[model samples]
Target chain A: MSMDFGFDMITEDEYQRQRALYEPLTEAVRRLIYASLHTDVGADAAAEARTKIEAVTALLETEQRASVPLVHENTGRPLAWANPAVGLRNAIAPPMVIHHEDDGSCWSEFTLSGAYEGPPGWVHGGICALVLDHLLGEAASEGLTQPKFTGTISLRYLRGTPLGPLRAEAFVERTEGVKTFARGYLKDADGATVEAEGVFIRPAWARDAG
Target chain B: MSMDFGFDMITEDEYQRQRALYEPLTEAVRRLIYASLHTDVGADAAAEARTKIEAVTALLETEQRASVPLVHENTGRPLAWANPAVGLRNAIAPPMVIHHEDDGSCWSEFTLSGAYEGPPGWVHGGICALVLDHLLGEAASEGLTQPKFTGTISLRYLRGTPLGPLRAEAFVERTEGVKTFARGYLKDADGATVEAEGVFIRPAWARDAG
Candidate 1:
């Protein structure tokens, strides 16, 4: 079933508690994922693991499945688990901490872990593109207004983004009707590593979807 | 430990089988990940799931943790489960089936599922970039010679890549010394949705690493 993600019905206090309850579960799942990457035991050992997994799966199945929402209702809250880029609940996510500004802009800071490595001692370029798309999209809507979709994004890689702490910033350049132009860049301690610009649009149907 | 991704040591046959065995495991994990996204039960229900998870984690701990390889060793086998673009072992992967041609070019076909959706009816722009980056990188190397790192990639979104089966192609345009220039585009049933050009380089250090 389709569900609305606009946080109009959720309160700040309720959102905080709801997020708090699931943090540990997502963290555990993330650990399991990274652990699995390194584990491929003997057939006997794997059989044992499978048995354990089956039990967990059975228990999860007993409960009613909550329809997964791709976008959070209250976009302002650092609903870390829901987001694919910075969501802590997701193991694949870099889980950057994002901050929104009043001037239709946003910034995020995070350390790219070994899990995100692509090249030798460098973060994956595709991952960088994912982060920028999310950053610019958030800036376009400030994660508070009608959702804006990424119409187009162009990126330039100045250098390899080293696998460590990095900062990224996005600012809206101009808005022509429903299309908002935004530019963003990522920087490691040394300086800028990647720069991007994109067109984000609030389609006519976005309001109807919410 | 630093490992070489050069596939020189692997045979085509072994590559094929290794991928086959792991495909199911990745598919199971993918299901688990999506399943987890939909399950946020009460504390009691979650505790049961956690207990079962702990049991599995304990069993896995008995063995030495495998060093996760970002890139597979046998790069040319079209190992559907090892690649981030087509690797079935990783749920985050798009699992494209790629066919490499003799003329130093490659093509991949896959569908953008609900998991990869960004806009209402389109694939994520970053996902397109990710696929293009991989497509072009594969074209640059063709899984044969020296490793080529993504030096720079520029993308222009012609239109939204509809969420369904799509094809992407990449071919080397020209090479100047270590620099290999490549171009790629993604297409749905209708026509091209995104186009990209990138420079892949056989870095001097890449030789040393391999």
Candidate 2:
């Protein structure tokens, strides 16, 4: 999760293209990260990683902080769209690609990898809730003109979600002033694995601005 | 979260020593990882990381899979004791160093960095629940002579948890048959930020084996 930071200065199309171009490298980095965890290698490898940090920091300093594009220029969305857990660009995202339909409902399809596992072959339960809560909140925001923040969420793990392809669907159940109620469930090939209900609030920024 | 893998074959003292020795390197790697995400460097930087993977993988292959210690051998705890979210060795864990007290309660102290941020200056709400759930489950398991898994967790975000030093505490509320009830909250310098309640189940492995 990230803030809009209101730093978007590029065209949305350009941002998307850059995100696409940069994805594979990011993924390679993530895989290597997990590999680093298991290796019994000594300080030399870790030192190399640390050494690269200074050079990278110098490159970043070249870009004026305020001028850097923080969000997608077209969508006003933050760079979190690259987050591994739910990032669209990241193959690692339980990739929860949400589609908001004309009928006031939303659904997504994605897969989980070994990285997200909790129990031997199962997706972490917290990750299940993470995807569900994000989907439900997005479902709630589909009708609104502004962003909504998750206020509370309740999750019931009916069964362990396996580490592979899965689907989820959510819809707004009701609305009372600032609160939007939503419910959803996750399913693997076998059947529904988890369910969630959430209340999302139109935060002060959205409420006051919109 | 990871499986115990039953691969722990080392003495508890050996495990602790290795954990202590390797912790700083793991932390440096983690910080570099988050830094990598934001760096605008070209292929050279990413290539350097890729090159390191092969050497690391070779070192890991040297150890026979059956002999590798995957967790704290004495406790049979998965190596995730170093996981970024709750790991003591990881700088990102919120560290959540839990202390199980004589009165049947547990508490932890930790901090959140920019890597864990969401909603601007606050820690991600899902992460807040992740820590609370883990803590509550651990608290529930304190009196039991067996392991437990999280059954259900309910969280309410009363306020955004600031991205800095924070504290969390949990205690078993009650127990019935295989279920243990626990509750806890997260606090920053100002006050409580999030509160949670959870039910943890002692699975058949813990029930039958222990």
Candidate 3:
């Protein structure tokens, strides 16, 4: 049984082209989602808008891929264009962009809009879990040079994360052979709203490849 | 301080009317997201589509709400229109419709598409977390009558959940005071792909109200 997670390898130039192409489209779609939620348009106008959206869908579907391709730069960083956490093309993602520190930690600062609400005015707890999981995974992967899958993750919600600008950071707490234990938090201006700890494991194939 | 989670109260008739209006819009936007991921249209066409989408957004925005309203039936079931898990108006949700069994368990059957992919073709681990969290929360709430917030939830990924038709279910294992312990799984055709356990806490306000 092969555990080869097929990734599309592309040059940096090609990665840039696709990113440029899809990022804005994802943004447009994101705005479309937000508008759909808050819109108070009359039924006739709403119907008209839906028709226009349907037309766009048809145009885009004219040239469709069987699946979203996960692209990796020849240099090794992953550009998973369809990833729900940080995918450049996935509108569902808050599209967190992580920054790797010299100290082997990762952090991201992003904003959540109305589309992610769970409670009336707060960011959804699951969405928080999604962001933290991705951050911890990035930390566990050690800059995406070594891929790791999340084995288990636990979160404690100390306070509600308000729907606005927020910060999340994760660091490798330790590594025991094939597994890496990492910890991180989601924060607002006051302090940590949610704290998380996760165990990420390197698959046998990845370990063997390494 | 009052912990009143301000939920808009509406009649069942109003709920039905809003559901009729937004459900199809959400479905359309969901298809738009799927199309965005799979689309391989020419640059010119993509740009043109963006223009049209922007126009639709503007039209929708002509009448907008200050925030996404969380509505509840005057009879008490939450109709969180903006919830990322089961919101009728949220395109980001797989829009899971949970079925509560007589024995206090909840299950949802839905399909995830390219938008939810985390690793190549498989469903993202964080997405699994999101789904499980919502499912377990539903169970803890006991059919949205007794509201509880997720305090801590843990997940163990036994295998990758594929981005296709899938099933998820959760049930309350026990409850001690204000805390409910629930367990659930995400499954593909074969068997359980991910298993989860969660502790959901009924807020002091909810407790007081009860």
Candidate 4:
């Protein structure tokens, strides 16, 4: 018996709603991250951004209710780990994603609220992992050299990946036999920050089988 | 109310049974992985191991189905993504792992069966991502590192990571403020094969409030 499962489609309106809800405050954090990497911004900057981000996210989430539908039970949403539905209880995220299709490159956005803070108020280290995982995974599966999942992934945080309105972009790098390689960057609004590379493998099961 | 979740301990027999059911095959694969990496042997050596691994794991699963419920729903085990019950019905694993205790490193493993085969008899690529995520996350959370998740990850698959009994190890290299920097390697019994690096962040949310 054969069946069709809907795995590749998500609406644009839903995307906008999520984006508005996340309200990422991207530009500010981007500039701040750039400075830290290029200049001797010190640890205080991460602390400052964490604090500023938490306050902003707190205001956005105040109106949110803990009781919400869990759209992601399995195929974990990228930011679902911290959703209020789960009680906004833990801000850390694992390497899952909420993918939206794009023509040229894969794009995704998520917000880091109080739950993700570090220092006096900054995004936590683990949260960065979740963000990158979601973004990179989505990138690997789409418009890339070939659809591969992470065989191995590496990251260099050049600087603290501040909290709040963050944006991440991923593009395919190259391919070899059953392996596909990719590179990506996460930025608030500043530019050229938090770089990463991932190996997407088309498991023996899914490969050629398609 | 203080609550105690009955997960902190396990019986010695249970440990042994678990090892018998899970570890030996993984070890065999690990040995092959090491050989594939350090020696002049081609990736085909790992391929040979995967075949042996699949045969062993299938028999183990059939033999232990009654004694050791490998499926998550049947056993009520928390890390269902790696459980066969979620129905990959194969040897490949998802990249997410939960129920990690204070082991200093969090890890999940599965012996690739025919179900995970990519080539005539190889494991799938996506499954590799699932394993690495579990490894790197565990490594970051180890000791004074404050258990941060992956902020960013980079992976280099020097060659096809053969499917078989495989071992992935991750450990912290250093830390920067609230972020822990770490690297991990996936090795077979012989030596190093796939290497990875990541930034583990202790999200702002998990910190104790003053």
Candidate 5:
């Protein structure tokens, strides 16, 4: 089945402008999140901070979008500013920068702070799954040229991943008609900690468009 | 084979007090996140908001925890305030409250706003995996009477889960010594959109303690 969300197409200049507008804000919010967890401020200080934060929220709410806009760059790349994985405007996403290799593989190097801990100092297993899922989907999408959705993804946690500098990589294993199979892993300084595989399917609409 | 992070045990009173202090702040940050995405405020207002947020962060930084503490309720349940899935103090978490059923199953009902969107209005697939993994782990843990780490989890996306009210439920399918097999699904109003199965493994330390 096919579905349409009516994505808008924007000029490259507009994409760059939006990027410039939102990226730093997203970064600031990310720092706020990390601070919220580690902050040992007194109750009164925290309450006052909350009030300041709420005032900022109120000011922002003065003007709002009905829904997040789905736009495509003039170069045909999808630009989703609200995506939790890699959106330039999403503070919840890790500061991941995925590198696309010439051989159609994707890899990212990033750091996880205390916010991502699951087992004590180790990273959360679900966070590991989240990163792998996105990287694998990117590999399956072939740099967004195919635009596939995650059909099935599986992960095995070999050992605990420490919450610090980490690396993840994924590559398309094979493609069968509309579905692409991809595999990847998360690694620390020592070696692989989690391995993942996924199947990504090109939607009927995208296939039809092609 | 085993590890220790020196989790502290907190009194019920302390837990309640901490909860009271942080829950509202977490909620406020959640609203801030939503507003940050939907806000159409002019650049000057947005920049001003950033400055105010930075000030708050600086105030918080005056006192900070070296790392996120893994605490346990006096009654033994893990209390991870930084958990992205169910941390009461984590703003990045969608507001979810899991209810444990007598039959060893766990379920939660929550709404995903625009911040969780992946493909336009649908929830991010990685997010589905995140929630499912946590729910399934909770089920395997049997209300934290026994602790287990996710060994492997797999999900199949049957359809898109819209970004609104959704329900997720998980239960233990079986247990084989150190491993517990669990299954779960995410559903919108109409029906199930994603199905998942997971293996939760009791660490050697826990087994030895038993």
Candidate 6:
């Protein structure tokens, strides 16, 4: 039904490192949003919020995660190796949890809210891009084997992305050297109306070792 | 200072031909948006809406009417062409436009409102994509005789795009046959923060005689 070749990516160790690095932040974002919504607490809680936020920021201070990346033994070439710093407190995270991480792809889910609205009662287009960027960013990493920055992305809005609760899905479509192609969609319960395709590149500045 | 490159396009005649051939819904959109805001007034009425709202559509219609597209010669190319089709009117204009011709660089702008809100006070991300897609789709067509579909688009969200009036700008950077590399950014009026950046493409399926 669609033209997709599926990307071939990194290794299990790299996957774990990426997950451990991002999951905490994702979890923190989820918690912060929940607290912001559920608690009737006022600005005085701003300090409390900082404390709570710090609970998660603590993860970044712990240690530096290393990734050897994938390599082709015969060619003696480093297969894929790239990582970029995606600073904490991501703008979009409907409380996503990294569910599974296989060799060449990663899967996660998040909900939407009033904070991300645009047309009438729909999610803002920028928020849609934010969600997809992260999804595609993860997908582009090919399940942590290599990390890449989006070189390009295309989006099709089939229907209005309603506000409130929505979901997004992203996965790798294919890979050629440092370039990784991916696709993602964001939708309300029914189906996708906002779809995106992206190409991610592992920049030359990134670490590389065979 | 910015990353967009829209200074160079092709001939005005080719622009006219390209415009004639384009099928974007811009005019329809202008009419729809005008009607929605000026609900009780007819197009014949001169001073209908309040300052910021009145003639908004007419002004757009005028600009749409006056703007000249750049189309390539033997290899007619520019940055986007739209052949808008007449369409139905409603509360808000739909964000759809057909691009006719391109020379690889240009800029596009559109405004949305509560009609596209998802959050209580924020705009929807999907709507952002809609506008961005239209602009990128236009950029994708640049420097080529015929237009192209989006092969990929990448977006970066630097901050939350506030609700109310906003603008989108897209232009091409370079071209490589079927692949045209381009970037765009969406900025709120204050300009303090950029909601997003986009890198879009023109697919091979859309290529025509150079």
Best-matching candidate per lDDT: 3
- List the candidates ranked by lDDT, beginning with the highest: 3, 5, 1, 2, 6, 4
lDDT of 5 by residue, B1-210 (tens): 346656667788888877777788778888888888777776788789888889988987898876645455654777767888887777878856889988999999998887887777688888898889888988999865576889999999998889889999999999998999999999999989999999999987778788
DockQ of candidate 3? 0.74
Better model by TM-score: candidate 2 vs candidate 3: 3
Interface DockQ of each model? 0.39, 0.35, 0.74, 0.05, 0.72, 0.04
Q: How well does candidate 4 reproduce the true complex, by DockQ?
A: 0.05
Instruction: Report the lDDT tens digits of candidate 2 across residue range A183-207.
Output: 9988988778888888988877667
Instruction: Give per-residue CA lDDT, model 1, range B82-174, as digits (tens).
Output: 344555555567677778888878998887664565554567677788889888887887753456778778777777788789999999999
Chain B TM-score of model 3, please? 0.91
Where is the poorest 10-residue window by lDDT in model 5 chain B?
Answer: B66-75
Cα error, residue A150 of model 5, in Å, equals: 1.5
Model 6 per-residue lDDT tens digits across residues B1-210: 111223335666745543333212223223322223212222222122222222222222222222233335534443322211001111122333333334544443345544343222444443455456446545655423334444445555444466666666667776676666666666787662233334444333334534
Instruction: Tell the DockQ for candidate 6.
Output: 0.04
Question: Per-residue lDDT for B181 in model 6?
Answer: 65
Error of 5 at B10 (Å): 2.6
lDDT of 1: 0.68
- Report candidate 1's interface RMSD in Å: 3.2
Which whole-number lDDT from 0 to 100 does residue A92 have in model 2? Answer: 31
Following a full C-alpha superposition, what root-mean-square deviation does model 5 have from the true structure? 2.2
What global local distance difference test value does model 2 have?
0.64
Candidate number of the best DockQ? 3
- TM-score of model 2 (first chain only): 0.75
Better of 2 and 6 by TM-score: 2
Return the TM-score for candidate 1, rounded to 2 decimals.
0.82
lDDT of 3 by residue, A29-56 (tens): 9999999988877778878988899999
lDDT by residue for model 6 over A1-210, one digit each (tens)? 121113335466755554454444333332333223222232333334334333322323233223223343333323322211121222222434443355545555555554344322455454566566656666776543453455656666565577676667777788787877888787777888678887777756464732
